[model samples]
Target: MAKLPTARIDKLLSSMGYGSRREMAALAKAGGIKLDGQALADVSDRIALNPDLPQRMRVAGKALDPLQGLVLMLNKPLGMTCSHKEEGALVYEVLPERWRRRDPMISTIGRLDKQTSGLLLMTDDGALLHRVISPKMHVTKSYLATLDRDLRGDEGAMFASGEMMLEGETKPLEPAVLEVISERQARLTVTEGRYHQVRRMFAAVGNHVTALHRESMGRLHLPEGLDPGQTKLLDADEIALIFA
Candidate 1:
């Protein structure tokens, strides 16, 4: 069997944003770090780093946080910027403050403008983030759009033609699916994450999206009970659905 990865307890704790290395030493002295039900005598002790660590390790009397490859599914709220530096409300504010400090910080896989809301993904796994966002993956994203005016019946055909090109864009968009819910509301599914693509698509046909909310990415839909601004850690099965 392969040797399990190992790291100094203080280093691991600090990397997880529990505290700085010096702080971890103090925490260990105060009986705030434990492994396998025993308080650690030294913060410098080496420990196996594996999936089971969360269950076997305790920090400040609580189970350790999820390990490095964390993925989160969030119900994005309107008016929240998906940026870390922009002003006003930020999506990261909904997460535990310490998570923002994690080494290899969590970042949204793709962005949603402040005006849009719905299913959004964040991950610390850089490869996974890039895989889902890669154009070659063609991961489908579904959106529900409330429009400013009635739909012209041709909107669906136009979108599905694979010939639609947003203004100022050189390449045609891949064929998209548009399911009309009403004269003024529609659900659109797209494979590309171009800047404001959904909104731009509507504008191309002389209509405007009054409200836009993402409903799904591939087979993963936003949980109906997940309120705006709330988040859930995606498990292995849920993560697989994005590639399904």
Candidate 2:
């Protein structure tokens, strides 16, 4: 059997956002780039991006064992927008250069406004993103809302009924869940990704939403102690949990 052709590590990873050639060279000089658990002495060396060949490439501490897929959950902070062309800082900026643009191109699974904060999902798998966030799938997104006053008038029943006529919608919602935690705090869960749905839902019932924080999407909850502006790659199980 013949060996596969190799790709320049710097070319492949730099295109994936590892860094500039000089920056990668610096990392190589500092002994940060590795191949198959061995420190690579040269950043420009060509190697097969083959996961099956037992030659993994690592930058900093992240191992790009398989160069085809990536999924990350970020604890998005307040005031930073989510977009490829937004005017301000982007959530994806927290990730390493390699995680930014590659063959498949990374993108957010869904989106959170600059004000909302919590578990934000990013991935290079287009099908997975669609499977999880598509309205037809009915995946539930949970939110912790701080309101101006107590929920009144059978709000829970109304949410469960899905008959509230929100503005610009031709019909009612697909039913939602609302649980009061206190006079001013509540947990709301909904399946649709309607623009400002949670805030508007409370407003429809005559309450004002003051603070909105997403808590979960599907079975994937933002892990405890994962602070704002921090991010971590999803473990295999954690990735599965998003669809579980």
Candidate 3:
């Protein structure tokens, strides 16, 4: 048997994007890790990936990858949770089985609520995740909201001035653009990403959001004809736009 330098399984899994280092260790302890034909005995065990050995290596019965990262965007459909639980509907449920079979697990950078649907970015790249979600970056997210009522005159001014109160609190939002699509619809652009912010901001301005859809995050727009629940790989330019 050709012996390869061994490292802790948890560390290997973390570097492979399986999960964070801490989470991967916990999974290994739970008998969720195996190597060769035997259950993993030590989280720190150095295992040889000898090609000569049958069942050379596996994690949760899945082969491990030593290179490459996965990234993609999904036009998430409403009603799917963002969690990874085996039961109940989740965004992963909509992904093909082949994707789920990959060694490194993909994770969403930021999540959309089950009731709200639009573009969502998922990747195994930890640095990219931090760059997009960190508040200091101030990445703008544009959304189109269909409201139950129309906004005119003072209502339109209120949205632009950032004077809306969210959840009865008096904190002003960043400058936003509100354009009337119709008497009952509007397009809103915001730089701050608060939880349920679009809905709350509209509600604070006395308009109830009936349906909300995110059109873009930063400069990356949902590609034309990407139906709900569809996803496509983002190219270098598309990814760069999000940070730019």
Candidate 4:
């Protein structure tokens, strides 16, 4: 396991919704917080410098255990919705309770729709989510789409130039990269993620996307051996790929 870095005790706890740092400090002042079986004297006191060394912390008669902020790449299966609504099977239900409990806000990096599947990343880190999903960063997402018919005409050129008009959007979409993978399939690369974008792009060209499977986001690709509905924690190097 990788070592968890050190930070202020109250700040860490507050990030986990324990309370604000000042509030936690006041609680410490009231003798409600304990460290190693003694009343904590300083809110600034830091423990957990090493993930190997377990630190005992308690508040309001309950232990305060911090998660290491796990990032998981899930191979989303069909019939799942990433959101919490009951419109379909909740995607986070596929995660173990341990990961789902990181916070109520753990979310998929980008949505894969109810029927589209593959390469969904889930995490509790708000900073990581914003950095990866922000449109200004130009991070590329790649997908393999099965279409209703063979691609024809200057679809590739059209996608490359951002010449196609999507409905109800004021600005033309940023250019997409489309390639013919087979008679009924093609690979697409795009930076911006409008609603049902790959399907819409194909529809604009008079073809229909019958199936869509995202292959990669930035440098992170779904490993072939990973099966649908399975998840694996992303290592440090793999997490770095989100910003690449």
Candidate 5:
């Protein structure tokens, strides 16, 4: 039997959603791509896709596609790290014993600092992760924050006026929705996710965030009645909202 014709290196990498044509070409030039039984010689080089090829393809010695992709949301409890650090409690630790046993190798779409909690998503779909995290997508994330003090009248205007500075940056934040929920709590909705942003923003205006909880991402709200450390699989529409 005749072997199938080879696919161009750039085409294969692009189909895998590694990058755009130009970017994939650069990666190929940097020796970042491989084909069955040989390193890709050029971005335009044609390489056959062997149906019998082993699942463990190498790119910079990193394993590819060892586990199926999974998308789920967890109500992350404080004190769990988002990373897979060996020394500390990672977010996966809070999953039911069955999920850990499956060893699906999921990762968070974005991180919630160890001190903040709620509406965290874990998945292995790199394409969707990239889309949602990319600034171009402009996905909105909402949070309910409990502060140490109340904002007096007209203080909420600062959110729209860009008076808040998140940590590790000198520039003010993009416009956001800030509404008082109570004397010591408020709802904040923003399109950008910066490090400790909620806390820093409150601090910039003479208030302190005592507790923070994310309520939604895009159109998907945290599952009703979900308690801390619990998780559930996301439905199709909910998944669509992440990219919407």
Candidate 6:
């Protein structure tokens, strides 16, 4: 097998937003860093970084945080922008304060407008993030939309026609699935992440979306009862479901 990557203990902790290198050194001196139940005597000592590292090492008496390739699912609430510099409440604020300072900052795989809510994926794994968002991936995203007017009945066929063009866009959209729930509510599943696509789809048909909530991405449904703004770390299997 190939060797695992390694980093100086202090540097690793610092990069993970534990503290500055000086703080890590002081933490080590106080027996706050440990490997295999023994205090790490030197902050300068290097250690292999593997998936199991979180199970083996303890920092300040707590297991190390998930490593760089971490991915998480957030049940985003309405009114929070999926942005780093937007003026109002931001999705990042829901995460631990220190996580915002990690070297490889976590970011949303795609965006949900401030008026929308529901399943949102965030990750520090750049490659995985790109893979999920790439147009070539055709990752399906589903949303529940509550509209201001009753469905005109032809909306389903229009959306699935694969020829509807949103205003200001030059290309036709891929075929999307529309399942009507009530006169004014429907579930829409689309393969693309075009800006405001769901809401725009309704507008193109002369209706207005009053509320929107994402329901799923690919085959992974948001867990039942997960409250708004709550987050769950995704394991390898959960991540694979996105591509499955």
Candidate 1: segments with Cα more than 4 A from true spot = none
Per-candidate TM equals 0.98, 0.80, 0.68, 0.76, 0.67, 0.98
Give per-residue CA lDDT, model 2, range 1-244, as digits (tens): 7786777777776767667778878888888987778898776788875645324656787766345556888899988788988888898788766566566778888889888888899888898889988887888899999999887859999999968889778889989998889988999999998888999999988999888899998899998898998987776788887667
lDDT of 5 by residue, 1-244 (tens): 9977676756655554445668877766676655454556577877666643324355544433222345789999988888877567789887654345343346788899887889999876777787888877889899999988877756578887866666577787888888888888999988887777778888877889889999999888887789989888776778998756
Q: Compared with the true structure, what per-residue lDDT tens digits does model 6 show for residues 1-244?
A: 9999999999998989999999999999999999999999799999999889999999999999988999999999999999999899999999998889898999999999999999999999999999999999999999999999999999999999999999999999999999999999999999999999999999999999999999999999999989999999999999999987
- How would you encode candidate 3's per-residue C-alpha lDDT over 1-244 as one tens digit per residue? 5556655666766656567667777877877776656677577766554433324667766765433245688998888888887456799877765456445567787888888888898887788888899878878888889988877546667767756667756677767877778888888887777788888888777789988888888889998899988888776788988877
Error of 4 at 202 (Å): 0.5
lDDT (Cα, tens digit) per residue for candidate 1, span 67-145: 9999999999999999989899999999898899998899999999999999999999999999999999999999999
Query: What local distance difference test score does each model get?
Result: 0.94, 0.82, 0.75, 0.82, 0.74, 0.95
- Model 4, residue 131: C-alpha shift (Å): 0.9
Model 3 residue runs over 4 Å out of place are: 1-68, 101-104, 168-170
On the 0 to 100 scale, the lDDT of residue 127 in model 1 is 97
Residue 127 CA displacement from its true place in model 3, Å? 1.4
Q: After superposition, how far is residue 165 of candidate 4 from its true place, in Å?
A: 1.6
> Arrange candidates by lDDT, highest first: which order?
6, 1, 2, 4, 3, 5
Candidate 4, residues 1-244, lDDT tens digits: the string is 7775787878766766666789889998988888678888698988665543234767866766545565889999988999966666889899755445444457888788999999999988778888888999888999999999888867889888966778777788889888787888889999988899889888988999899999999888999899999988887899888668
How much is the lDDT of residue 12 in candidate 1?
A: 86
- lDDT against true structure, model 4: 0.82
Which candidate would rank higher by TM-score, 4 or 6?
6
Residue pairs whose backbone atoms clash in candidate 3: none
Clashing pairs for model 6 are none
